[model samples]
Target: MVNVGAKMDERMEINILDYRLKVMSIAKPAIERFTHALIDVLFFKSYLSGGCANNQHGFVSVTETDADYSVIVEEEAYKAFEGKSQDVKVNEQTWLPLVASTGPAMVVQNAAGISKIANSVVIPLADRGISVYPLSTYKTDYVLIQEADFDKVCEVLAQNFRITREGHLQSSEIVVEPTRVQKALPSGAGNSRALTHTFDCSDTNTYCMTSMDSKSLEPHGLAIIKALLYSGHQSEVQTSYFFNLSIIEQDISLILNVTLLNKFPAHLFFDNSEYWRLITIGDMPEGVGFRQAGIVAQISEPIASADISEYYISSFYYGHAFVPFDQFDEVRRLLIKKQNSQKAAAAAKLSNGL
Candidate 1:
C-alpha cells in the first residue's frame, strides 16, 4: 500500500507514461483499390430506411443519425449506384443524392473513444503534412486520405499509433468486464429531467486501467472505463455534473466500493468517514490538500491484486495518473495540478463573461 502524502511542490507538464502500446490499422489494400473516392453525408427527415442500409454494402463506412446519415463509399460502390434510385423517400419527402470526391478511407477501432487515440494518430498526421477528413462511428474512427498520400499516412499512423493490420488491440489477457445500468436519478443533479437518467456500473469488478490487460477488456467495457478516466470537468451544469457523478458512481464505486456497498446507491451516512471519503477524496478533489491524500489506496485496498495494480493511469486527453504507488505520487500530484488549473481556467472564463 502507498501513502500519497500531503502537498508536493508544483510541477510542470507531465507526458503520458510511454506504454509502448501497439495499435492496429488497415490501410494498404484500401489504398490499392481506390484512387478516386466519393464520400456522401446524407440528410433525412428521419432514420434511413432498410434500403439505404442494404445499399451501403461496399462503403468505406456508414453512420446513421436521427436526422441524417453519412457514408464514405468506395468509387465502385458509388459507380454501382443507379443515381435516381439512391434517393431515400421518407414520409412523402425525397432526399436527392449527391456524390463528391474525397480521400481514400481507413478505420481505427479503439475501445477508449476518440480522445484516447486522437492525439496519438491525428497530430502526427498533421505534422507530416497529411490532411485527414475524419468520420466517427460508434465502434471505430474513420479517416479519408488521398490515395496518393496513403503511404505517408500509413507510415505515420503505424509508427506513432502502432497501428496493425488487425485494426484493434489484439491481446490475450483476461479481464472482468464492466456492466452498465441506466437508472433514473434519485434526485436530479442539474438539468437532467425528473425521469431522466444516470449511468451506474452494476458490476463490482476492478481491472488494470494502464496495463496491457487493458487492451483485452470488452470494447464496450473499455469504452465506459475510458469515459470515466478521460472525463474532464465541464463548466456546464448538465455536462459537468454528469462527469463528476459518473466518476463517483462508476470508477470510484464500481472499482472501489466492492465490500462496503454492493448495491447501486449506498446507504452510508453523511457523517461517516467512508461517505466523506467517497465525496471528498475519492471523487478527485478540485484543490490540493493533505486530507485528500491516500484516496487512491482507500478505493483500491479491497480489490488489490497482483495482476492488476491499485493504480492505473488514464491516457486520455492530457493524461491523469491514478496510480496509488508512492513512485507515481509525483505523477498523481501533477494530475491534481492539471485538474485544478483546468477548473481555475473554467472559473476565470465564466467570470470574464466569455
Candidate 2:
C-alpha cells in the first residue's frame, strides 16, 4: 500500500492560486462567433497590468474534443462571453485553481511523475468527496475546485500537508491544525465503481504536446495567433478529435493534432518532435456534472502502474489521456487486460450473489 501523505510530501509542492476561474463549453459550430474575442484574451487582454508580482492573471485554456470546445478562463477574461450566455453553456459557480509543482529542480519528463502527483493529491481529495477538475501542461499540473469549497479543501489537505495561497495578495501560508490521522492510500481507491464508462483510442488522429515560454511569443505571437484563427476555418481542423491551448502565467502549452500543428512554424515550440496518441474516456452520464471523482486516478493509475508515461486533460465534458505514439499499443493492451480482469471478477461476484 502507498503512504498517501508521504508520497505527497516527497512529490508535490502546491499553491492555491488567487484567480477566480470559469469553465464554459461551446459547440464547435458556434465558436466562430467569438473567435476574435478569444484571440484577444490569448494575446492581449489576458496579461495583467503593472509589475504586480502576480502578473499571472491572464489564464485561458481552450480544449477541443469531438463533441464541443471547453474553455477555462479567468473571471475577468470571461467578460468576452457575456450577454451571449445563451450560445454558451457556462458553469455559474466560480472555481479556484490549485497549482501543484514537483519543485524547480525537478522536471517531469514522463507520465510516471505525473501519475504519482495525481495519485497523491487527487486521490486523497476524491476519497474525501472533493470533486476536482485536473489540467496538465508540459511543466505543471492544476487542480481546480469550486470557490465555495476552498476553505473546506484547505482544511482537509492541511491536515496531511501544508497549504499556501499564490499571488501577491495572499502569499501567506494557510494556518491550520492537524485534526485527522494520515492513512495509507486504499487499494483501488479511485476506481470508477459507480459509473459505467469505457476507454477507447482515437482512430483518426495523433497529437503533439509542446510548449513555449510566454515571453517567446513576443517575437511571433500575432502570426501564430493568426494561423490559429485561420486554421479554425478549416473543416478538417474543426472536426479534429483533440487540440488544446493553455496559457497560465508564463507557461504556454499546446496539444495539437498533426494537421493543425503544421499551421505553426517549428521554431515556436520545444519537444515538437515527439508525438502522442489519444485515449478518449467515455463521457460521464448526464446529470453527473463534475461531481464524479477519481476518473483521472482510474486511468492514470493503470498507466502509471505499467510505468507508462501519460498526459491527462479533463475538460468540462470529457477526459483525455495522451500517450507517446510509440507506446500507445502497449498502453492499450495493458488497459484492455486490466478491464478484462475487472469484468471477470465482477461476473464471479454476481454469480455468487455476494
Candidate 3:
C-alpha cells in the first residue's frame, strides 16, 4: 500500500490549461438531437483542434446522468449547440481549467489520497468564498474556476502550491504576491440552504470507472468511437443513464454504467472491477453560473471525514459524486447528517438574531 500521507506532503504542481470552456447540459429527452454534435466533438478531425496557439492540446468532457447530460467544451465547439433546442441550458460564463498533480503519477488505488488532494485545494478556496467546479480523472483532479475568479484563486492558493501555465510552446510560472494574506470565514457562514437541498442520490444504476492510454486510440479508436455512436442511439431505449468520457492530453478516463461495459473490450482498460454509486447535485437556478462558494466542500467534507472513497465531476448544470457501491448507503447517511447540522446551525443563528 502506498503511504498516502507522505504522498500528500509532496510539492504540488498545478497546470493552468489555456482554454476558454463553456458548460452545457441537455435534458435526456433532448439528447437525440445533439447526438451528431457530440460525435463530432469526440471523433471528427475538425473538432479535435487544440484551443491554444500551437493547436496541439485541447480538452473536452461529456457526462450523462439520470437527470441530464453535462458537457464541457471549448467556446468555439459550443456553436454546434446554438439554437438547437429549448431543452438545452448553457452557462454564459467562461471557465479556465487547472490540473493538479503531486508526483510523477497519482495512484487511484488509495481512496484517502484522492480525498486529501481534493480537500487541500477545495476547502481553502471554499473558506475564502471562492467558487470552484472540480472534476477527477484516473490520473489527477481538475479544478475549473470562472475566468473572473482566476486572479483571486491565484492569490488564495499561491502560498502552498506551485502554479504554472501550460498548452503553449513554453510553460511559464505564475508569480505569487508575498504580501497577500488569506482570509478565514466566520463561524456559521456560506449557503447552507444550497448545501442542504441541492443534492440527491441516484438509486437506479451502478457504475464502473475505468481508463485507457491515449495511445490506445491509435489502434482501437475507430471501434471505440463506433461504440459511442451506438450508445448515443441506445439512449432512446434508456438502457443506461450515466457515461463520462474525459480526454486530457495523456489520459482518457471513462465512467460508464456497468450494464454497458460489454460495448468495449475488457482488455482495453486498466481495471474493470470497481463499482460506484451516483449522487447528483441538482443544477443551480438559471443564471447562477456555478459560482456559489462551498458547494464542493459541503459535499466532499462529510464523505472524506468518513474516509470514504469518492469522485466528483462538476458539469455546467450539475455536480456528480460517485462512491463505492457498498459505501453508498453510508455516504447518504453522512450527507443527511451534514445537511441537518447545517440546518440546525442556521436555525440557531436565526434564533440569536431574534
Of the candidates numbered 1 and 3, which has the greater TM-score value?
3
Give the lowest summed-lDDT range of ten residues in model 2.
104-113
lDDT (10s digit) by residue, model 1, range 4-83: 11111121111111111111111222321222221121111012234333332222332221112223333333433323
Instruction: Give me the runs in candidate 1 sitting further than 4 Å from their true place.
Output: 1-69, 82-111, 161-354
Clashing residue pairs for model 1: 23-162, 24-164, 25-164, 104-145
Residues 1-354 of candidate 2: C-alpha lDDT, one tens digit per residue = 223244345544568887899999876688779887787777777445642245455677888766677899888778878678566888888999887666322333455435646555666666666777778787777888888877767766654555668766558666554444444347666445332457877555778888986667768777666554445566665444667888887778888888777767777788788888888776544423676666666677667766677788877777788888899999888888878888898899999996
Candidate 3 lDDT over 54-107, as tens digits, reads 233657788865556788888877889877899888877888988777543332
lDDT per prediction?
A: 0.25, 0.71, 0.70
As for lDDT, the candidate ahead, 1 or 3, is 3
Task: Assess the local accuracy of residue 174 in candidate 2 as a C-alpha lDDT between 0 and 100.
Answer: 65
Ranking by TM-score: 2, 3, 1
Q: Which stretches of candidate 3 lie over 4 Å from their true place?
A: 1-10, 47-56, 83-87, 103-114, 181-194, 215-240, 283-289, 346-354
lDDT of 2 at 61: 86
TM-score of each: 0.24, 0.84, 0.81
Better of 1 and 2 by TM-score: 2
